[model samples]
Every structure is written in structure tokens, then in C-alpha cells.
Target: MDHLIEFWPILKRLIKYAIPWKKKIILAFCLLISGATSEVLGPILISYFINNILSKHKFYFQSTLIIIAIFIILQILAVFFNYFQSIYFNKIAVRVINKLRNDVMNSAIKQPIYQFDSQPIGQIISKVTNDTEVIKELYDTVAPTLFRSITLIIIILFAMFTLEWHMAIIAIFIIPLVIVIMSIYQYYSTPLLRNVRYYLANINNKFNETINGMNVIQQFRQQNRFKKSIQNSSQLHYLARMRILKLDGFLLRPLLSLISALVLCSFIFSFSYFKNEVFEVGILYAFITYLGRLNEPLISITIQQSILQQAIVAGERIFSLIDSKKQEYGRNKKRFKTGKINIKNLSFSYSENQKNILNNINIDIPSKSFVAFVGHTGSGKSTLANLLMGYYPIKHGEIYLDDKPINSISHCVLRKNILIVQQDPIILADTFFSNIALGRKISEDEIWKILKIVNLFSLVKSMPKGLYSILGEEGNTLSVGQKQLLSIARILVKNPKILILDEATANIDSGTEKLIQKTLSFIKKNTTLIVIAHRLSTIVDADLIIVLDKGNIVEFGKHEKLLKIKGCYSKMYNFQLSKY
Candidate 1:
């Protein structure tokens, strides 16, 4: 019951997608009716043959053969119509699944960054893959089965009534009883199926996590631990499956028993009451055959109840994700051009109750000036950079670009003029030129110029295919320094107004660092540069230096001025000087 309630929203959404296929669905219905009518008439024709030809010894051989031929032709036509109906329904299922998957993926990509941080990657993957598959099964298998079962039941009832009204009434009575049993079964079985689906999702999530982190497990020599965890998850999944199967077994046996009992009572009553009438043995046989046909559709509907419930549970989960709050995008907002930045009373914290990660940070960067942020680990340097980049919302203050509040500007506008290169570079497995260009189309001359600026021109020239050379899997073939240089070269081609290098030189040797630093300095003439570094020597010639401690600006001045003060920056500078 709970699972059905949960899935109700998803079913409603699915029904919206079905609207486009109403014509095909109508055609399918017409085919189903035609097929059922032909099926019902088959037994009646056999009965006619037995009574008229064998029993009564009728000798109209030519007409009898024609009637038999017509019946065979009708059966063949019914098979063709059934096939068409199946094909049409399958098409509708595919259309619905495609639309649903697209909507879910779009919603996921638009979700706030914090949401991605909070949720497990494996669980998200399960939703996209496994949960969507359940929805597809609902449309492809359960929906058609349900519709066909209903059509069969209706046709069977109508045919039985035409043959013997009293017997039809008795059969109808059993239907109400069957309905009550189904209701009870659904009420009990829904929760069990819901548990089964939940456990199954967990199992999938665990499997994905294990596979993605296989390298980590091997590195730590924790294969046994992972194996044990997988075993435990598998056992839980098995138990959940068993619970559902047990419930199904209990419901199925009782339903089948009741159906059998109904058939027996109907037969006994027919034999007792109609024995005196000149009823043909063929008619009796046909009625029994119809009774046999009736049980199958009923059983099919009963079995589909479990699958329908599972789909509903899946739908609920999918819809919940789709309806989650997405990252805010400003509408009808004015766009801004790149210029100087101002941070005022900017006290920021990741969580509301947690300690502030940035405290009363007041700073100003003149247009095209190179500013450096220097601090020890856990000093909130990266957090400050994230704030400046608009990756995190300002908590207790405002950031202004060109003396206008950054919050007033749209993300698209901000991203257009700002770029950041991080410590760990993002390298896709693609041709060297494609990786450099990302998705943008740039001139070959521009690509070469950027590569030359980063001193990667010789390396590209040495490759057999030059810029067309393929980088396998996250550019695994390239050294760390080379990857970093490639990333810098990629960004240099874009030529943004504001450039941020967040620990960009941390992984490279001093020689490579010097080359990158020289290139960055050359570019700083026109672009405003913000360098976050632990190596004070790299930023010794910066226009200004800001020393951060526990999210607060403990000291802020030029290197010479801060050094003369002998504050936090002075101690760090002197320590580094002694080490060198």
C-alpha cells in the first residue's frame, strides 16, 4: 500500500508521456477485441462440428469444410492482429522510457553542487541505470499484460453470459471474491515488494562502489574486507527476494485454489441442473474449455501486481530526485563585464552553525593586478578562492566586481569572464587538440600559440600525429607536470579576464614551475591574476599578499611591508628562506 502511494506521482507523470501514443493505443485495443472475439468463437465452432456432424450424422460435407476453413482463417487473422498490437505497445514503451531518462538526467545535471557532494555517486548511478530500468519494465511488460488481462476477462464474461446466464452469474460472483482476494494480497504484498526494491537498489549501489574503487581496495590490501562487505550485501538482497517470493507463493496458492473451487462448483451445478435438457456433450466441453481459459488471464493479472508495485517504488524515487531543488539561475538579470574585484565584511561558513571558513575578509584587486594568497594548510586559502570564484555563496557580506555586487550577476555571466585551473587537472581521453579545445572551436594558429606559450610546442611537434595524438584515459600517458601544462595551455587559448591558479604549481618540479610562472607573469599584463600558493617564493613579486589564518585575514600588505612588520607572513617567509 505504501509503495503504491509512493509511486502514484510517477505513474501520473508516465501517463502524461502516453498522451502522444493514444492513437496507437486505440489501435492496439481494437486488435485485442478482434483477437478475443475470434478466440471465443473457436470453441463454439468446434462444438458445432461435434453436435451437427458426429452426433446428429449431418452430411453437408462441402459447407462443413468451408466453415472449418473460415475458422482457421479467423485464427490466423487473430495472430496477425496480436502481433501488431505487441509491436505498437513496445514502441510506446520505448518512447516513454526515452523521455523519462532525458528528464531525469537533465534534472541531475542542474542540481546544486552541494547536493552532489552530499549524495553517494554509486546511489546516483543506481537511480539513473537500475531505477530507470524498472520503469521501462513497467511500461514494456506490466502495462500491456494488465490491459490484455482486463480485455480477456471482459470477453470471457460476455461469452459465458451468452451461453448460460445463470452460470455466468455464478462466475461473476467468483470474480468479486477474486477481486477481494487481490485487494488483500496487494495490501500485504506491496510493502514486501517495496523492501525488495530498496534492498536491490542498495545491492546495485554497493556493487558500483566496489567496482569504481577497486584500485583503492587493492592499494590498501583490503580485498578480504571488500569481499566480506559484498557477501553481506548479497545475503541481505537474497533475504529481501525470499520475503517477496514467500508472499507471492502464499497469495498464488490460495487464489488458484479458490479459482479451482469455483470451477468445480460451476461444473457440478451445470451437470445437476442441465442434465435433463437435450444439451450437447460438445457444449459442455466448450464451457469447460472457456473456464480453463479464464483462469490464465486472472493469474496473469495477479502476478503482475508485484511487478507493478516494484515499478511504482522506483518511480517514486526517480520523481523525488527530479523534483529536488536545482541551483538557482537568475532570470532577467543584467550581465557584467570583467574588471576589478572588492570583498567586504565577507564572513563565510560552509554550515550555518560551524566555524566561519572566512572571517571579515576585506580586500580589493585593481583591474589587471596580480594578487597572491599565501597561508599554511587548514588556513582556509582554498575556501577563500572558492568564494571569489562564486562556487560558494557569500554568507555575511558581499563581493563586488567593478563596484557592483557579484550576487546580482548571473552565473553564466560570471563564468563567461572567469577561469580557474586547479591542482588536479581535468583530462578527458580524446585527441590532444580536442582536449585543448574542450568543446569550443578554435583556430589552429591560436592552439599553436597557446602551446608555444606553455613550452609544449616541441612535445606536440615530436608526437607522430602532433596535435591529433590521442591521450588514453584521463591523459594517463602524460606526466603530472605535462598534464598541468596542457591544462594551462587549454585555458590560455580561452583568454578570460580573470585567471585563478589554485595550487597549480604544487605537483611540478622547480624548473617546470619557473616556466609556468614566467608564462603566467607574461599573461598578467592584461588579465587579473589570483594565485593561491604555499610556496612563498613563487608569489614574491606579487602586487600584494594576504595572509589568512582560520578564515580570517591575519595580515595583508606587500611582501616588503609585511616582512618589515614581522607578522605571520614574515615568519612564513623567513622559514622558507632558511629552508632554501
Candidate 2:
């Protein structure tokens, strides 16, 4: 009730996630009603047994037996209703949460490439795992318990007024006092619990950062600093909990019990002053029984209020992710017949305030021609390659694939035709065969043939499990060069019409470079090959060498032709030659 108006929209958004389980929710509500009816009748049946048997001093055997049987029947009915309620609610809770988790993950996976570059992996993962788990209480326990508690309170209040209005007046009058206590408790505790959730996410993000960068942390001896950061985050989370603990220790349970005592003492005072026959001790007993029952739900509602606070915070985070922009794919599904790529006055930068990484560039790469983009570091060679792969939207200039705008081509068609092999391989923690084929229907024979083309067949064939051996999470078993070769084998299996090797061999040794160079020579025969390289010697045989400096291409021609001009390319070539 603290922010009920603002909370309603979030509640409504969360409810939509449960729409598919509406029938189950309705059935669970029916069971809850039945259970609450049984709960209310408990006080009534006990009242009747005490009033009739004790007050009249005449116990009819049949009447006493009937009351006993009704008591047993109420209890048995309660057990059945509770059983079905738990069954239906729990089942639907898990299903709804599973769907929500899936939607969050799918949204994360399909975000724009730049999102992964800018957003922390830990932050994204915390929203999916930690925040979603907190929101889960909306279904798992809080929703059903909140429903049953409110229904039982209503039933109990109804019975109290009907049986003895005088005592009921005293009991009901204290509810506003209890509501005030709750509102006060909520006022302080909401922000505390919210801080708790926030710090929990901070811990998640920090811990994730710590584990992922453990190598860097150790290499630079920054472990102590990272430890301090994690400890600070954990301490903040602990402080938030201590505040909630202070509130819970003194405010809620004790205050509600005090009100409960007041309700009971007021009943005793009325009994002492009023006429003896006018007040049946049985009614007083039943009223006390209902008062005791009232105590738990009141405290529970307070607890549920705190849970609602957490859920609101978690829901906002979750829906924010679901509402974030997803990667766009064009509607057209046209396929490129050849590998011809054209660029006209291409220029781009990551942000508006930043300088362009590629500037006023123009080039034409014919089908199946070998083109190398050679530049010093920060000259935008790799950025241009990423743009050509349709990794970013064409903002500053036009890129055409067979005379059609790149955005007009379908992602499926584009991905099927173009591939990029990065400098570092991304090996899954699975078998080599699975890594290469990755759930495709390529045959074992065809896979072996492709591996042979990359000169890895004999190496794989001599292993213990051959292609079936599981790779480590980082592919620690394979050398850098071997990993690059395996990545190329993946491209060969797909056999894209175009391949861009973005510094794919920059990290390998010279001995391994010859092997990769041989593989590239074989690949250049069939596809339009583009190489973004730091090493000068690797691209000397390139049909066209494009040299860039400060986002502008300063030279473009055959390697020997550029060398003859004694420009930036020749200087870089001479620098590398002196180093070797």
C-alpha cells in the first residue's frame, strides 16, 4: 500500500507473464476459497460444541457425536483443499517463471553486437539469474499465501461480527492501528529491502568481473584490490540486512502481538462488567480462538508487503531488459549470387562525439579476389571488416552486395554467405566435431574432408578420442595456431562465398604462420578473401593492398606498386623488414 498506485503497473506487467497459466490460477483460487471456508467453520463448529455441551449441561449423545464428526470432516476437507492448492499453484509458478527466464535470455542473446561490447556481462547475467529469482516469489509462495491470508481474515471477521458484535467491535477497531503499524513498517523497510536487492546485484556483478578477469588480476598482482572491492560490496549488502533486521526485531511481530493482547484484554473487561448470563463464556472462547488465528495472517501480510517491495524492484529490472532494443534483421531474404562487394565514401565512428574510425573510404572488391587491408594499429582496418560483415548498421556510407544495399539482404542470407574468423578462437566445452559442425547436418565424411583441407585430419586422427574428445572451456589443449586452423575448418565446412580474417594469425609464431598462410592460399582460390593483418610479409602476395592511416586510405595497389611509391605502406614495410 505504500506505493500501490505505482506498483499496479508493474504488477500488471508481471501478471501478463502468467496469462498462459490462467486456468491453473483459477483452479487454485477455488481451492483457496474452499480452504478458507474450512478455516472459518473451524471457529464456528468449536463455538457450537462449547455452547451446546457446556452451557446447557445436557449432552445429547447424537448431538455430541454429530459435532465430533463435523470437526473431523472440516479437517479432512482442509487437507484436500490445501493439497490441490499447493499442486496447482506450484506447477503454474514453475511454468511461468521458466517462460519468463527464457524470454529474458532470448532478449539478451539477440541484442545488438555493440550492446555486448558496452554492457557488462555480469550485469546482464544478474538480471537473468538473480533478479528473476527474486521476482519468482510473486508466483511460488507470496501470491498464493497473500490470497489465502486475506480471504481467511475476511471470513474470520465475518464470523466474529455475526457471533458477538460487542467483542467484534473491539477486535475490528484495532485493525486500523495494525494497518498503521504496517504502513510505518513498510515506509522504512521498503527502501532497506530495495537497497538489499541492489547490493546483491552489485555483488553478483563484481564477483562475475573478478572471476572472468582472474587472469589479469593475478598477472598484475591486483588480487588484493579486487578482494577489497568485493568485500565492500558484501559489507553494503550486510548493512542493508542489518537495517531490515532492526525493523523486524522491534516493529512488526511485537507490535502486532501487543494489539492482539489489547483485543483479548478488552474482551475480558467487558465480560467482568456485563451481566453473567448475557455473555456466554463459549463466545468469548471462540472469539479468543479467532483472535489467535488473526495474529499470524496480520504478521504475514506485513511480511508479504516486504516481499511485494522486492518483487516490484526486481520486476522493473526484468522488464527493462525485455523492453530493450533487439538486433534488427531485414525482411528481405535475397541471396547474393557472387561475392562482389562495393563501398562508396564509407565513413563511421562508434559515437557522435568520437572521431571516425574509418573515413571517406572507397573501394571495389571483385568476386573471389584476394584483398588485404593493411594499416597501423587504430587505423580502422578491423572496424571496416566488421562493418562489411553487417555487424553494424550502415550509417555514414553505402555498402552494396551485388548492387543491393547490405541492410536489404536477409540476415540468414548474409550469414550464410559471409564469415569472419577472429584472431582468437571461441571453442565451446564440447567435442571438436561438435564445435566444427555445431548441430549442422554435415556428414562425418564431409567433416573429415574439410579437416583434411585445413591440414588437421592427421592430427585429429591420431588422438585418443579423435574428434570426439572434449575440449576445455578455453580450449587449453590446442595451441594458438591449431585453434585458428580449427576455426578455419569451421569456415570450410560452411563454405561461405566471402571470408574476412581479422588478425587471425597475429598472435601465432612464424612457424605456424606458414601453415596458416598455406591454408589461406588454398582458400583464396574459391572465395572472396579479405585479410586484415598486422604482419606485412603475410600480405605481400595480396592482389590488392589497401593501406590506411588515421582512418583515410593513403595507398591502394599491388604490394610492389605501393612499394615503388615510397609512401606510408613502404615505411611500414621497411619498419617490419628491419625488425625481422
Candidate 3:
């Protein structure tokens, strides 16, 4: 009862998904009740025949045949009703799970960037796939079985009362005993099931991380380490399941069967001693038959407790994800007029407890200007760019795009105006046209023009199908330089107001770097270019360069002005020059 109270909200949310199919669910239940009625009537008809016909020493052949035929038909109707009920219930279950899986995925994609930073990708995947699948089992099997078992119990109790009220009262006591057993199981098993789910999610996270970093692991000979890690996670999951199994072995069927036997003995002994009427063989037979039949549903209810607990755990996980706060966006429809950006006293940390990744700093970027930010690793270069793109909420200070607060802008306007190309750009396994256009209906001629602008025209012309040819998974068919150039083409096609290149030229060969440089020179006239520079030579011609150290802006000027000052920017440039 306590566990039900604690999880009532989650259970209510799961029921809402089924509310849309209420009519079908109602029809299924009607079928279930009809079947249970037919099943209960069978025993009563036989008891009447035994008492009035055989025991009275008067057997009518035609009457007995009719009774036997009616009994057979009742049993057949029960089977038929059960079959159709199962069909309807299963159909509803499949549809509910499909909608739930889609909703989980949609919520996942809309989560804030920081959410992903805190939650592993694999754990999210487990919630969508593994956890939801368990929930489906709840609807498909556990729910229906419990409902059928309960309907049978109720109808059988009614039948027992009609025959003999004394025994009926004794039979009803099984319900409270069953409820007590279920409550005990819930108290002990809920925490264990939760641990099992947590370990399962951890195992999935470990596998995902290992697979993504397989090359690194092999190079460092860390295979054994990862294997042990996964083995430990699996062992924990196994132990939790084993503990539940031990609980089930002690508490579920065997215990319920014992209660059934004890109840039957007390019922028989009381009927013989307390009643003043003479012994009737038919009454004894009917009472014993009803009591024996009652045990089946009682045992079934106990057996379903484990599945119910699992479903509740899975539901809690899925609902927590679905109910988490999505990325907040305002409804302001104002569009960017000049693409100018101003940052005033801006400071940010990923979380409250940590020190700021970008300290109190200030800068203004003019429209259509070529600007560069240079810093060593962890100097908050990418963090600033992330802030500008509105990835994280600004708490300490303000950021304005085109003189309007960035947060006040609507999601559509913000995304359409400001775009960033990361150091490692994501390339899907798709055609050249699809990758570049990104589901937009750009003409082939326009795509060809952008391709030529990025100097990828020759490579596409060499392909068998040109624009329609598939890029292998993660664009494995293309070199890293080619992938980087392709990503640049993707941005240019959109013609965003602001374009950020975060170390885009870091790993590419010099030839590709030179091509990117040339491409940047072409687009700098119209697009506001913000480059997080890796090769300082690539940004020597910028209108301004800002140098950062420990999240503070230590120097800012043009190339010659900064060089004459011989500050952080000059030292970084000379260091790269010396290395080359």
C-alpha cells in the first residue's frame, strides 16, 4: 500500500496513455466478465444435476443429455470470450508502447545541451528501448492476467454464496491474506528492482563508452579493464535478480497454496460441525470444487507480483525523463537585423557548485566582421561560443544579439540566425545533397554552386551518382579534411547571420586548411565569422583578435597591434610559427 501511494502519480501517467484506447479496453473487459460468468456457471449446473437427478434415484436420459450439452457449450463460450479479449488487450498494448517510445525520443532530442552533459547517451537509450519494453510487458501480460484472475475470483465468490453462505464467508478471507502477501513483496522488492534497473543502465553506458572509444582502449591495452567493468555491472544486475528470485521462492506460490489448503480444511470442518442439516454428498462436492477452483486465480495473482514491480520501476524511469524540463524558449518573434553581438559582464558555469568556465568578461562583435578568439586548451574559448549560441542559460550577465536579449528571442529565430560548426562536425550516413541541405528543398544547381565554392565539386563529379550517392556511416568514405569542408558547405548553404568555426582546421592537412582559409575569405563579406583559432596563421588577417587565459580576456587587438604589444596572442602566434 505504501509503494502504491508513492508511485501513484507514475501509474496515473501510464494510464493516461491507455485512456485514448478506453473504448477498446472497455470492450475487452466486458468480454472478460462474460467469460468469467460462463466459467463460474459450469460448476453450479453440475451440482444441481448431481443433487436432483442421480442422488434422488431418478435419471431422465434426455434431461441429462441436455444438461451435459449446456455444460460443454458454456465451457466453449468461455474459451472464445478469453481469446478475443486477449486480442484486444494486446493490440492496445502495442499501440501504447509505440506512442510511448516516440514520446521518450522526442523529449530526449529537445533536452538542453547541459542535460546531455550530465546524462550518458547510453542510459537515455536504455530508457527508450529496454525500459519501455518492460513496460509493454506490464500491459501485455501482467495487467490482463491480474484482471482475468480478479474477475474469476469475484464471480466464483458470488457462485459460492448462492450455494452455501457459510463456506462463501470462509472463502472470502483468502483475499486479505493475498493482499498482505503482495504488500510484503512490494516492501522488500521495490528497492531491489530499482537497483537492478540502475545497474542495467550502467551496463549500457559502459558498453556505449567502450564502443565509441574502442580504438583508444586497444592502443592502450585497456580491453581487460573494460571487460572487468562490464562484468562487475552484470554481476550486480544478476545479484539483484537472484535476490528477487529468492523472495519469490519463499513468498509467492508455495505460501499461497498452503493458505488455500488451510482455508479449505477449516471450511470443511466448520460445515460438518456447525450445520444442523443432514450430510449431503452433492453439497460437499460443490463446496470442495469451488474451493479448489478458487486457488488457481489466487496463485495467479501472486505470480504476477514480480512483473508488476518491474513495470512500476520502468514506468518511474520513463516518466522522469518525459517529465524533465525541456529547453526553454521564448515566443519573441523579432529577427536579427544586423547580426551584431554584445556580451556585458558575462560569466557562466555548467553548474552552481563549480567555478565559472567563462569569468566576468566583455566584448562586442560588429556585424559582417572577421573576428578570432585564440586560447590554449580549457581557456573557455568553446564555452564562450556555446554561450553566444544560447546553448546554456545566462545567469550572471547579459548577451544581446542585434541589441536584443538573446534569451528573449524565439527558438526558431535564434537557431536560424546563429550557427556553429564544431571541431568535430556531425556527418550522417546520407547523400551529399541530404547532408548539405539538411531536409531543405534547395535546388540541385544551388547545391552544385556551394559544392564548387567549398572546392568539393570535383569530388562529387567523380562519384557514380553525384549528389545522390550515399556517404557511408559518419562519412567514412570521405577524408577528415573533406568532411570538414563538407560541413562548411552545409553552413554556407544556410546563409546564417553568424557562423562560428571552433577549431575546424585543427586536424586537417595544410592543403585542406588553405582551402578553408580561401573559403572563409569568400564568405567574410556577408557572414559574421567567429573563428576559435587553432592555427593562429589562419586568423592573422582578422579585424580583431582576443586572447584568453584562465577564462579572462588578457589581450585584444589587430594582428600587428597585438604583436607589437608582445602579449598572450603574440606569444601563441610565435610559438606556433617556431613549431612549424
Candidate 4:
């Protein structure tokens, strides 16, 4: 009862996914009933043959052949119905699980960016993939088997009562015993199944982290440590599975078989004790056959308890993800016309318990100017960029674009106008053209023109398929400079009003930096180009440079003016100059 109370709501939610295919589910169940009825009738026909025809010395060859033919036809019809019902159930399960996986994926994507910071990628993937697959087993295997077994048990019970009322009363007592067994199984197995799922998810997380960091692991010769970690996770999963197996071996089929043997002995003794000259052989045969059939379903029901528990656990995880708070966007449809940005009294912390990442930042960035922000590590450079992109909610700040509050801007307008190019650009495994256009309907001519401007036209032309060549996973075929150029090309096609280059030239060669500089000269004429500088040489020509220290703006001036002041920026620039 406690398990049912916990699982009822999840079952109710699962029904909604199945409701869309109600017609097919209903037809399949009807076929299942028909199949079970046919199975019940077959034993009765055999009993009639044994008592009325074979024993009485009245067997006509044609009559006996007719009865035999009818028996075969009944069995064949039962098989036919059962097969089609299973097919329908499998089809519905596929469609329902597909919809569920889509919902899980959509929910994961819609969660706030900060949520991803707290959650592992592998755990999220496990929810969408592994958990959904287990739920699929509920629909396809556990659900259908339980329904069919119950149907068959009910039909067999009715047939038993028709044979002998006293025996039927005895047979019905097995149901309560089976129920008790199932209840016990549920109590022991639910927690074990939940543990199995947790360890499995942990294994997936370890594998994902290892695969993504294989280079570092091998470089530092830490493969043995990672291997041991994954093995420990797998060992935990195996122990849980073995515990469930031992519980099942002790509680499920063996207990039912014991009851079956005792019941069989009671039925045989009842027949011997109640015997009379008029006792019919057909009735005795039918009762025993019905008894055997009854045990089959009882055994099946008990065996499926493990699968049902697993489904319940998987459903809980999937629903938890689906119920996570999604990032909400405003309804304002206004787009930025001029890229002027204003920040006033801005302060932010990643969490309430942590120190502020940005402390009372105030700045006025004019339209169509080249501005640079330079700071030491942990000096709130990336945090400010994240806030400007609206990746995190602003708790105590006012950011405005064109005199409108940043939060008032609709998601569509903000995404379309304010774009950032990170240090390591994301390159997909697709043709160069799709990577640049990114679902936009940019002309091939315009794309080629931009490639030439970025000095990548020669690289593309040299490829086997030119712009149509596949970039492979993460654009592994391309150099770092080439990938960065591709990121810029993506920005060029969008022509965003406010473009941020977040350390874009921090990892590239000198030649690529020069090309990027020339490209920035073109971009700054009509867009707000904000550069977060790592190498001071790139930002030396900026119209304005801001230096930050420990989340506070320390100085703001032209590069030469800052050098004369000999403050933080001057020391940092001179240090980098000394390195080269």
C-alpha cells in the first residue's frame, strides 16, 4: 500500500502519454481477452472428448476428427490473437517512449544556464536516455504481461468453478497468498532498484567525464585512477543487481511453486475422498488442468514485480527533470536599434552564500565604438559578460540597451542582436556552409565573400568538397585559428548590433590575430565591439580600456593614458610585453 501510494501519481502521469493512442490500446486489449477465452475453452473441449466419446465406446471416426479439428482451430486462433496484440502493444510503447524522450530532452534544454553548472552532463543524459528506456519496458513488457496474466487467471478461475464449486473456493485462496508475496517483493526490491539506477547514472557520468578529458588523463598518466573509479561504480551496480536477484530467487517463483504443489496435493486428496460411482472423469480432468493454468499466471505476475519497480524508479527521475524550473523570457518585442549599453549600480553573485562576482559596476558603452575590458583572473570579466547575455538573472542591477531595461527585451530580440564569440568556438560536425549560415538562408556568394575577407577562402577551396566538406566532430580537421575564423564568420552573417569577442584571439597564431584585428576594424564601423582582452597587444588600439581588480573597476582611460598612470593595466601590459 505504501509503494502504491508513492507510485500512483507517476502511473497517472504515464497514462497521459498512452492516452493519445487509446484506440489501438483498446483494440489490443480486446484481442487479448479473445485469446484468453479461446485458451480456456480448449481444455473444456478435451475433457468432453475424454468423458463423452472415448470412454463410452461410441467414437465415430468422423466425429472424433471433427472434435480434434476444432481443438486445433481454437489453439491456432489463440496464437493469432496473442501475436497481434503483442505487436500493437510494442508499437504503442515505441511511440509513447519516443514522446517521453522528447519531453525530457526539451525540459533539459529549457532549464536555466546556471542549472547546468550544478548538474553533470552525463547524469542529464542518463535521465533522457537510460531512464526512458526502462520506462519503455514498463509499457512493452511488464504492463502487457501483467494484464494478460490477470485476464488468463480470471478466465481459468471461472472454468474451475464450473467444474467443482468446492475446488474453485480452494483455488481462489491462492490469490491472497500471491498478493502477499508481491507486496513483500515490492518492499525489498524498490530501494534496491533505485540504487541500481543511481549507480548506473554514476557510471555514465564517470565515462562521460573520462572521455571528454582523455587527453589530460593520458598526458598526466592518470588512466589507472579513472579506470578504478569506473570499476568501483560498476561494482556497486553489480552488487545491487545481485541482491535483487537473490531476493527474486527466494521470493518470486519458488514460493508460488510451493503453494502450487500443496494445492495440487489437496485437489488430488479431495477427488479421492469425494469419489463415487457417478463421478465424471471429464470434470476431474478439467479441474486439474485449470489448476495448472492458474499457477502459470500467478508465477508470471510475481516475476514482473522487478520490472515494475524499475519503471517506477525511472519514472521518478524523468519526472524530476521534467519538473525543473525553466528559464522564463519577457513578452516585450522591441529590438535594439542602436547598440548603446548602460550599467548602473550592478552587483551579482553566483549564489547567495558566495561573495559578489561584480561589485557595483557602472559603465556607459556608446554605440559603434571599440571598447576593451582587461582584468586579472577572477576579476569578474566572464561573469559580467554572462550577465550581459542574460544567462543569469540579475539580482541587484539595472542593465539597459537603448534606454530599455534588459529584462524587458524579448528573448528573440536579445538573441538576435547581442551575440558573443567565445575563446574556443563551437564547431559542429557539418559542412562549412551550414556552420556559417546556421539555419539562416544566407547566399553562397555572400558566404564566400566573407570567407575571403577573413582569409579562409583559400582553405575552403583546397578542401575536397570546398564549402560542402564535413568539418567532423568539433571541427577536429581544422586548426584553432580556422575554427575561430569560422566563429567570426557565423557572427558576420548575423550582423549583430552588439558583438562581444570573449578572449577570441587568446589562443590563435599571430597571423590570425592580425586578420581578426583587420576584421574588427570593419566590424566597429557600425556595431558595438566589446573585446575581453587577454593579450594587451590586441587591445592597444581600442578607443577606451577598462581595468578591473577584485570585482571593482580600478581605472578607465585610453591605453597610453593607462600606461602613464602605471597602475594595474600598465603593470600587466608591461609584463606581457616582457614575455614576448
Q: Considering every candidate listed, which one attains the maximal lDDT?
A: 4
Candidate 1 contains a number of clashing pairs equal to: 0
Better of 1 and 4 by TM-score: 4
TM-score of each: 0.92, 0.94, 0.95, 0.97
What residue pairs clash in candidate 4, if any at all?
Answer: none
TM-score winner, 1 or 3:
3
Deviating ranges (above 4 Å) for candidate 3: 54-59, 270-279
Go through the candidates in order and give the clash count of each. Answer: 0, 0, 0, 0
Tens-digit per-residue lDDT, 1-580, candidate 3: 6687856777777888998999999999999888888888888889889888988999899999999999999999999999999999899999999999999999998899989988999899999989999899877788788898998888888888878787788889989999999889989999999999889999999999999899999999999999999999999999998999999999898899899899889877876787546435676678788777888888888878888788889999988898899988777888778879899999998888999888888999999999999999999999999988888899999998889898899999999888998888888999999999998879999999999999999999999999999999889899999999999998887788899999999989999999999998888878899999999988989998999988999999899999999888878889999999
1 or 2, which is superior by TM-score?
A: 2
In the order shown, the candidates' Cα RMSDs to the true structure are: 2.6, 2.3, 2.0, 1.5
Candidate 1 weakest lDDT stretch, 10 residues = 329-338
Per-residue CA lDDT of model 1 for 320-383, tens digit only, reads: 8899998764442554455588988898888888888788888989888889998889888888
Model 2: residues >4 Å from true position, as ranges? 1-6, 59-62, 174-191, 247-251
Query: By descending lDDT, how would the candidates be arranged?
Result: 4, 3, 2, 1
**Model 4 TM-score, all chains together:** 0.97
Worst 10 residues of 3 by lDDT: 275-284
- Write candidate 2's Cα lDDT for 177-244 as tens digits: 87888778767776787788778888988998898789999999999999999999999999999988
Best by TM-score: 4
